[model samples]
Target chain A: MGKLYVIGIGPGSIENMTLRAKEAIEKSDIIVGYTKYVDLIKTLAKGKEIFSTGMKGEEERCKEALRLSKDNIVSIISTGDAGIYGMAGLILELKDGEDVEVIPGITASSAAASVLGAPIMHDNCNISLSDLMTPYELIKKRIEMAAEGDFVISLYNPKSKGRPHYLRESLETIKKYRAGNTPVAVVKHALRDGQDVKLFNLDSFDDSQVDMMCIVIIGNSQSYIKQGEFITPRGYKL
Target chain B: MGKLYVIGIGPGSIENMTLRAKEAIEKSDIIVGYTKYVDLIKTLAKGKEIFSTGMKGEEERCKEALRLSKDNIVSIISTGDAGIYGMAGLILELKDGEDVEVIPGITASSAAASVLGAPIMHDNCNISLSDLMTPYELIKKRIEMAAEGDFVISLYNPKSKGRPHYLRESLETIKKYRAGNTPVAVVKHALRDGQDVKLFNLDSFDDSQVDMMCIVIIGNSQSYIKQGEFITPRGYKL
Candidate 1:
């Protein structure tokens, strides 16, 4: 049986792709991803079969990738770290095969954290507010727990147009347990097109500044914004 | 003023390095990092002046990297995602100028998390038990709270020759909150030389199986062992 490589391409940029990701992309006989991502890989992938789909069609794409991997080398690409909010969970759910190797990438939250500064340094937890398949009540409960535990929290899928008003509600939920002065940053389309990072306190945010692709990082009670940088000290220092 | 790129090279393997990391390393006139990490960039850094120092000498290294960036193109290399346990924090501490760019890399914990299955999916946090700078008391408190919150925890610097009993003590503390059957995986030199990923549970482990380079991930109450994979569901799918 041929092997399957589930790769994280790292936020849509060719530069952010690891050598292994590049090699996997180059060597794979078939590449499967969303149509937009397939277009992104067009230049690197020549004379190979390409399977593309639309948004929310990831399951279908993974199934195809698995079917192809039975006969030839196949790769499924996810933007940023493949495990965090990537195809990893879906693929694992399918339990396609034991030969599946999940190649991790720089997660969008990690990249955004790097760019936005260290609000997640100490005790941090990442939670997505998408509620697409997961219910909102569960997300709120998790957020409350993270806040109560004083965790520097990372929020993925914070906003969107059709799903627009979720961030405000999420912020309200966060504010219930966290102080209003808690540091919040909207890292929009990180490392991708239209990349913009904004540092602001949750209490002072302008709701007009975010969209779906943005990853919002909210610091714990201990998190502070220093000179446009959001930092949560890990409690260990020289 | 020349630009300073804080690039994350991901975990140990060169294949895990992003294309942007390679470009930054190539374009840099001066490469600053620990000697071991400087070695990681040696192949692509043919004409660059490499500035290296011993471990625990990071403050001086950061100052030198900053000083050189005033007149030259300089890049600081960190083994994992430069943000997570990387040199990006120290660089931000200096905050020399406004022209610094942070490029993210794959973090070791997440990479290990991927290899060990879903041990770090959600409702989790990462803590490093080096205690070189952090007090043991604080580490204990955080572990307790993490356990209380049911966090799937990733531990860095679990056991060194100098601190052979740290992991054992940690295991005791973790047992206070987590069940004996809680899954744990010690990934020694993950993706690096002599890499070995050992999977077990709290009830089955001893201190002899770990090292300083090993990253030990302890699962929460919800974590389980199946098919040789330590699984922690994010609860997103439900």
Candidate 2:
């Protein structure tokens, strides 16, 4: 039996990927991922068999990776960390006899947080606005609770072409518990090409600025913008 | 002025460090970090001037790094992601005339999540139990809200010899909202020497097993344990 490595390439930048993830990809005979994610690792995928599918084809991709891992060292890549909305869970569920190793990668939240300054220095929560797998009501409740708790919130898949109101709705829900002046940031394509970061207060936030490729960070009440940098202090007295 | 790189070395393992972080360290004239963090990157700091201080010396270390950056390229290292309870905020705050760049790293939550399956596949919250900086009441409130929101909870500094009851208190609070069967995993020294991973249910969890070095992940109600892996699915099927 061959080993199956589920790797997170880390925010679309080859420089952000860990040595372990890079080594796994380099050593794998076959690399499998979503087409976009496979394209991110094209340099490492050289001389290797590449298998990729389009969006919403995660199940097929995992099945294929598992099948290939039965006799070959296969690497299944996820854009961010493999364990977070990545292929680790599905592959683990479907792998019947193969040995699997999950190589962790830097997550999108951390990548975006790095770009946006220390907005996540304290307790923080991450919620996805995509209603594909989760109910809208549940996500709303989570947002409300997170706001009430004063946790810095990171919204993933906040806006897509099909779902335009989710980010707006999420912000509205947050506004009920958080002050209108709460600092927020939209990081598009963090650590990747065409990277753009914009800062806004809750009242001034424009949902149209976000899309599927962005990670939206909503700061806690204590979060502040300093010299154009979004920072949530680590409770240190300055 | 020379450049200052605030780098997250990533969960104690050199293999987990990003290429960017490694390169920044290699090119740095001096490396400054907490003593323990400095030890983690000793291999990369070979023959380089290293300035390390004991715990709670973050401010002094940041000041020293900033002072050194005025004349020499300096790398201030932090375990896990520099932005998450690491040195990025401190360095940024202390930097007056220097150019400081924060290089993101793999956080402990993501590292532990990979080891214990995909517990953070959806919304999650990270809370630290250490009361040195944050008030105990605020920590309790965040824990309560995170539990009420059903966010997968990752507890940093969950326990220490000095504060043994925090983990127990946190679990008791979480039990009010989540079921006793909710899966929890404690990962200590992830990806480094003497790494240990422990799986338990909420009811069966032992607080004595945890320490400051461990990251305790409590899954949401939707999470399940399959084949010894704790997986919180991405709600793909409902």
lDDT of 1 at B178: 83
Q: Report the C-alpha displacement of residue B71, candidate 1, in angstroms.
A: 1.1
> Stretches of candidate 2 above 4 Å error?
none
Docking tier of model 2: it is high
Kindly list the per-residue Cα lDDT of model 1 for residues A1-238, writing each as its tens digit: 7878888888877877788888988989988898887776678777988888999887788777877888888999888877766877666666645468888888878878977876566656777777666567766666666766566777877776766777787778778878889888889877777789988887897768776678888887777877788777654354
| Stretch of 10 with least lDDT, candidate 2 chain B | B89-98
Sliding window of 10 residues with minimal summed lDDT for model 1 chain B? B229-238
What's the CA error at residue B110 for candidate 1, in Å? 1.9
RMSD after Cα superposition, model 2: 1.1
How high a TM-score does candidate 1 get? 0.90
> Best candidate, lDDT-wise?
2
Candidate 2 structure, TM-score to reference: 0.98
In model 1, how large is the Cα lDDT of residue B168?
Answer: 82
lDDT of 1 by residue, B1-238 (tens): 7778887887767788888888888888999999988886678777789888999878888888888888889998888888776777777777757467788888878788778766765546777777776677767766766766566778877887877777788778889878898988999877777778887789998668777778999987877776777766555442
TM-score of chain A of each: 0.92, 0.98
